[model samples]
Target chain A: MELNKEEKAMASGELGEAVKWAINHQIKVGNFFDAKNFVSVSNVHMMIDPESVGIDGVLFLENLVGMGAKVKIPMITDPRGVDLNYYTPLGQTEEMANIERRTIKACTSMGILMTNTCVNYQTIMAPIFGEHVAYGDTGVVIYSNSVCGARSNYEGGPSALAAGLTGRTPRYGLHLEEKRIPTKKFLVKFKPEELTDWGLLGALIGKISGSYWEVPIIEGINHNPKSDELKHFGASMASYGSIPLFHMIGTTPEAKNYSSKFLNRLDDHIITLDDIISLKSQFGKKGDKIDVVVFAAPQLSIFEMQKVAELCIDKSFKVPVIICTSPQVYSDASRMKLIDQIEKTGAKVLEGTCFYNQYAREIGLANGWKRLMSNSAKIVNILGGYGYEPSLSSMENCIASAVAGEIV
Target chain B: MKTLLKCHIGIGKKVQGEVLSANDNFSARYDLDRLKGIFSRPQHKLVGKSYVDKILVLNESKGGVASAWMLYEMCARKMAPKAILFNKANTILAQGASLANLTICDRFIDGDITSLLSSGQRVTVDPMNGLVSIL
Candidate 1:
C-alpha cells in the first residue's frame, strides 16, 4: 500500500503510538486486499457493543485512550450491547454493563460520539454520494453504499476504530471503483408490499448472491421504497450475505449512473412470490405462539416509531413487545408522546440499542423466550443461531401477533 | 504423507492445528457460543463441536460485523480457533483476524477448502506464504 509522507510518519511512530498502530493495521489489511493506497474517509462509525467487545476490546480501547488517541474526523458508534438503564430486567449482567461503561468511557476519551445507532444513516448525517467512510454494522454499510451512494466496506469494530484514529482506510473492496459493478443481476417480479416483504426479497437476493464479493443488481421494483422499508431490505441482505454494497438499478445513485450498462442483462436471477414465500415458510406459521414481538434490527426511525405507536394506541399486548430505536429518534418520539403510546400497550422501547446486540442469547434464556417473532427479516435470521425459534412477518402482523400471543 | 494447498496470502502469523472443516458459513456473533468455545448455532454443520485452537475451515465468512471484536475477545480468552481458512473471506473477518492476530487464509488455488480437509486432520497454515500443508 502506498502511503503519503504523513502516513509514513505515522507508520514510523513519529505521529503517535495509536496512529502508528492504526496505520500499521490498515497497511496489513490493505496489503491483504491488494489496495493501492489509503483513501481519506469523511467520517467513521464503530460498533463497540459489550458482548462483542468483552474485556479485551475495552482494555484495548483504554490503552489507546491512555496513549492519547483521538479521532481525526467525526466518529460515531453503532448500537451498544447493554442499555444501561434497562439491562437487568432484560437479563444483561452487571459485568456486561460495566464493560459497556468502560468501553463508552474509553471511546469518549478518544472523542467518539456515542450515537449508539444502527440507523445512523436515517438519524445522523447520511453520507453523501461517493463519500468514503469507515462504517461498522452491515446494515449501515449496505444502506450508505446502496441508498446514499456512499462508499464503505463492512468495517468491523477494530477496523472502524482504526479509521476513526487515522481518518483514512485502506482503499480496497467497495472503495475501489471497478469492484462496485454489478456481479449478479436480479429481476424482482414479485411486489414487496410490506417491510417484511422487502426484507424477504433482499434476503433471498443476498442468499443467492452468496459471497461478500458478489454485488447483486436489482430491477423490476415498481414502487419507490420508503427509508424504513429499504432499511430492512439492506439490513437483511447484508445479514444474510455478508454483502457490503448493492445496486438497485433505478433507485440508488451509482446504479443510476451505470444504469445503461448494468441493466443490459437482468436475467441472472428471477425472483417471484413463490421464491419469497418459500423462504418465509421456513420461519413459522400462523397460530404458533410467539415468545416476544420485536420491531428492530436496523433500529426504528422516527417515522417508524410513529407508525408503531399508532398501532399500539388503544391496544394491549398478550406477549412482550420490544422496540429498539436510536437516541435521536427516541427523544423526538418521546417529545411527541409516541413512546408513551407504545408503552401504554405494554411495549418496551429501548433507546440507543438494537435487540440482537443486546445480549440476546442470555436474555432469551432468562425470559424463556425461545419463540421469537419479529418484523425484521434480519433479526429472524440472526436469532436462529442464538438458540431462538425466530419467526418473520410484517410490522402490522407482528403487532397483531403480540396482541393475540401467536403468529397471526 | 503431506500435501500443500496454495491459497491467497492472508493475515497473521503461521499456525499449525487440527482441522475442523465445514461447508457452512461462519459468524462469531451468529454461530458461536463463545463462553463454551463451541459452535452453538443449530443450523451450522459444526454445531456442538469445540473450535478452540482448531483450524476452522469454512465455506466463507458471513453475517454481522461483530466478529471483528469478538475475534479479539475470544483470542484473549484462548477460546478462538487457531486459524480460519475460508474458500472466500469477507472484509470483516480479515479485519478481525488482523486485530486478533489470528491466522486466516482464503481463496485456495486447490478449490473448496472444506472438501480438501476434514475434521481431525492435522495441518500447518502458513498465511504469509499462502500455503496450507495437510500433515
Candidate 2:
C-alpha cells in the first residue's frame, strides 16, 4: 500500500497516537485487499452498539479518547444497543446500560456525532452520486452504494473509525470502478405488493448472488418504490448476502451505464411467486404463538412510523410490541403523536436503538420471548440465531398478529 | 496424509492449530453465542461446536458489520478461534481479523477450503505467505 505524506505522518505518530493506530489499521486492511492507495472519504459512519463492542471495545475507544483522538470528517454512529431511557423494562441489565454509557462517552469525547441511526441516508445527509464515504451498517452501505450511487465497502466499527480519523480508506472493493459492475442478473416475474415482499425479493437475490464479490443486477421492476420499500429491500439484501452494492435496472443509477459498458448479455435467474413462497417457508408459519412483535432492523423512517401508528391505533396487543426508530425520527414521531398512539396499544417505543443490536439474546431470555414476529425481513433473518423463532409478514399483518398473540 | 495448500495473502500471524471445518457460512454476531464460544444458530451445521482456538474453516462470511468489533471482543476474552479460513471473506471479516490480529485467509488456489480440511485435522497456517500445511 502506498501512503501519501499525510498518511505517513499519521503512521509515524507525528499527528497523534489515535491517528497512528488508525492509519496502521487501515494499512493492514489495505494490504490484505491489495489496495494501491488511499481514497479520501467525505463522511464516516461507525457502528458501536454495546453488545458488539463489549468491554474490550469500550476500553479501546477510551484509550483513543485518552490520546485526544478526534475525527477529521463528519463521523456519525449507527443505532446503539441500549436505549438508556427504556432498557430495564425490556429486561436489559444495569451492566449492559453501563457499557452503553461508557461507549457513548468515549465516542463523544472523540467528537463523533451520536446519530444512532442505520437509516442515516434518509434522516441525515444522503451522499450524492459518485460520492465516497466510509459507512458501517450493512443496510446503510448497500443503500448508499446501490441507491445513492455512492461508494463504500462494508466498513465495520473499527474500519469506519479509522476512516473517520484519517479521512480516507483503502481504495479497493466498492471504491474501484470495476467492482461496482454487475456480475449476476435476475428478472422478477411478479410485482411485489408490499414492503415485506420487497424485502423477500431482495433476500432471494442476495442469497442467489451468494457473497460480497458478486454484484447483482435486478430487472422487471417497472414501478418506483417508496423510500421505505427500498430501505427494507436493501437492508435485507445486505443482511442475507453480505452484499454491498446492487443495481436495479431502470431504478438505480449506473445500472444502465455499467451494464452497457461491461456486459453483452444479462441472462440469469427468473424470480417468481413460488420462489418467494419457498423462501418464506423456512420461517415460522401462521398459528405459531408469538412471544413478541417488533418493528425495527433499519430504524423506522418517519413515513413508516406514521404507517405503523395508523395500524396500531385503537388496537390492543396480546403480545409485546416494540417499535424502534432513529432519534431524529423519534422526535418527529413524538411531535406528531404517532408514538403515543403506538404506545396506547400496549406497545413500547425505543429511541436510538435497533432491536437486533440491543442484547437480543439476553433480552429474549429475560422476557421468555421465544417466538418473535416482525415485518422487517432483515430482523427476522437475524433474530433466528439470537434464539428467537422469528416470523415475517407485512406491517399490517404483524400488527394484527401482535393483537392476536399468534401468527395470524 | 500431509499436504500443502496455497491461498490469497491474508491477515495476522503464522500459527498451527487443529481445524474445525464447516461448509456453512459464518457471522460472529448472527451465528455465534460468543459467551459460550459455540455456533448457537440452530440452523447452522456446527451448532454445538466450540470455535475457541481452532482453525475455524467455513464457506464464506455472511453479513453483519458487528462481527468486526465482536472479533476483537472475542479475542480479548480469550474465546476466539486461533484462525479462520473461508472460501471467500467479506470486508467485515477482513477488517475484523486485522483489528483482532487473528489469522484469517481465504481464496484457496487448490479448491474449496471446507472440502480440503476437516475437523480435528492439524494444520499450520502462514497467513502472510498464503500457505497452509495439513498434517
Candidate 3:
C-alpha cells in the first residue's frame, strides 16, 4: 500500500480521471500485483454496456482510442452490454440507439473487431493456451484465469481498455503466481449432471468463498462433466461472485498437475455437500411452482442456445420461456433456420438482451406471466429479488416449466 | 434542524450544517449531446433533475466513483453540493466525490434519529442517524 508522490497525486483524480492517469502512466500499486509482461497482443476481450450513448458512449470511445495511443486491439464483445435492454425494454430512444451505433462504429473503426457476443471465446478471440492478455469481460476474466490458464484480473473498463492499447497490464493480483493458490477445499457429494446444475453448484462455491479469493479443490464426485458444463460453472461463478480464478483438481490447466501455485493453504475453508445444499436455501427461496422460465443472465453461448432448443422437445410450455442468446449466435441460428424452429416451439428467442437487465415480472405479469424457473442459480437469486417465484432446475425442467406453466 | 455531515471514509473534514435536499442520481458516461431528442424516455430527462451540485454524497467506494463523477459534473455546472460525507475514502466513493466539486468531510459515527426528528421531509441515513430535515 506504499505510494510515491506521483501515484498519490494521481489517486486524487475523479475515478474516471484517476483511471485515465493509471492507464497513461502504468502506475502500479503493491496491492494491485501482476506476474510477467506479455506484449504485441492484437485481440482484446471487452465488456461494455451498449446503451452508453452520446456523451457516455462518445467519451468512452474517444478515451479508449486516445489511450491506446491510436493502436487498435481486436475487441471481443459482450452480448449483455450495459444491462440496458433488460432495464429499458420498451425500446431505446434515438440517443440510446445513437450511443450504441457510435460506440460500435468507433470500436470497429479503430480496428477493434466485435463479435458482438459474450460467447467471445467460442465465437471469436479464443486467446491461445498461454497468451498474456488484457480483458474486461467479467465472465471471460474468470474463464481465462480458470479454464484457459491465461492471465487477467477483473480489471475495470478503463484498465482493460488501456491494456488493450498498450498491450501491457500490471503483473499483479490474480496475475501473480502467488495469488493463484487455492484458498479453500470442497467435497462434492453429488455430481452436477447438467450445465444449469453446474451454475447452481458454482453459486454454492461462491457463497462459501464469500468475498475472498479461494482455490477450491474438490474430492469425491464420480460424474465428470464436459467442458461446456465447466464453462457454464466458471461463467456462473464469475457473475455471482467476484472470484477471478478458481481450479478443479482433476480439471483446469493450472490444477491439472496439482501445482504448488494452486495448492491448499492455512486460510482455506473446507466445504462439503451440506455446504452445497446450504447455498440453495441461503441464496435462493423455496416457493410455489414457476410460471415462466428465463435464461441467459450473463448471456448464453450458441451451445447453450442449442441445448435449450433440444431440451424443449416433449416439454409442453405453459409459461413464457425466454431464451436470450448473443447476437452472433442469433444471426447464425437465423441463417441455419434454428431461430424459426425455436420460435415455432412457442419460445421467444431474444438477442442483445440478458435477463438481468429486463423486468420479467412486469412484462410477465402484464402478459399473465407468473412464477419463474431457470437453471442458473445467479438468475434464480437475482430474479427472486425482483419478486419472481424463481426456482433452480435443469434445462429440461426449465423448458418443462415454460411449457407446463408450473415448476417441474 | 441541525445536520452533521461526516466522512465515513477517505480525506474530508466533518462539519455540522443546515439542510437542503437536492435529489438525483446522475451518470457521467451518459452522453448529454445525444439525449436531445430522447427526452420522452426517463433516462433522457436527466437534465434538470441531475443533482451534481457541490453536495456531498455518502455511498460505496468502488464502482460508485464513476456514477458519482457524473453527479459531480452536473452539479458543478449548476451549484456544488457545498460538501461531502463519505463512509470510506477508498476509490469506491472517493473517486466520484473527488470528481464532483465539493468540500470533503472526514468523520464517522452511528445512531438513529427517529426520536429526534419532528417534521419536514425527513431522510434518515440508517444506523448513522445522519438526519437531513428538508426545510
Residues A1-408 of candidate 3: C-alpha lDDT, one tens digit per residue: 444454344356533462455443344321212223333344566544543222543564666556443434555655543333433443334555455667666766556665556566666656666677766655676777777888665544445455565555555566567777766766666767677667767776765564325556555446666756766777666545446678776677776656544454434455455666666554335335566677876567777777776776555566667787777778888887776767777777777756644433345555555466777765665444334555777777667656656654
Tens digits of per-residue lDDT, candidate 1, A1-408, equal 888999999999998999999999989889889999999999999988998998998899999998889999999999988888898989888898999999999999999999999988888899999899999999999999999989999999999999999999999999988889888889889789888999999899889988899988888987788898889899999999988888886688877756555467555689999999999999999999898998889899998899999888888888999999999999999999999999988899999999999889899999999999998999999998789999988889999999899998
Off by over 4 Å in 3: A1-22, A25-42, A51-69, A80-95, A221-223, A256-274, A281-291, A314-316, A358-371, A383-389, B1-135
TM-score against truth, every candidate:
0.98, 0.99, 0.67
- The clash number for model 2 is 0
Best by TM-score: 2
Greater DockQ among 2 and 3 belongs to: 2
User: Which model scores highest in lDDT?
Assistant: 2
Error of 3 at A171 (Å): 2.4
* Poorly placed runs, candidate 2 (over 4 Å): A259-264
By summed lDDT, which 10 consecutive residues of candidate 1 chain B come out lowest?
Answer: B1-10
Q: For model 1, which pairs clash? A: none
TM-score-better candidate, 1 vs 2: 2
Model 1: residues >4 Å from true position, as ranges? A259-267
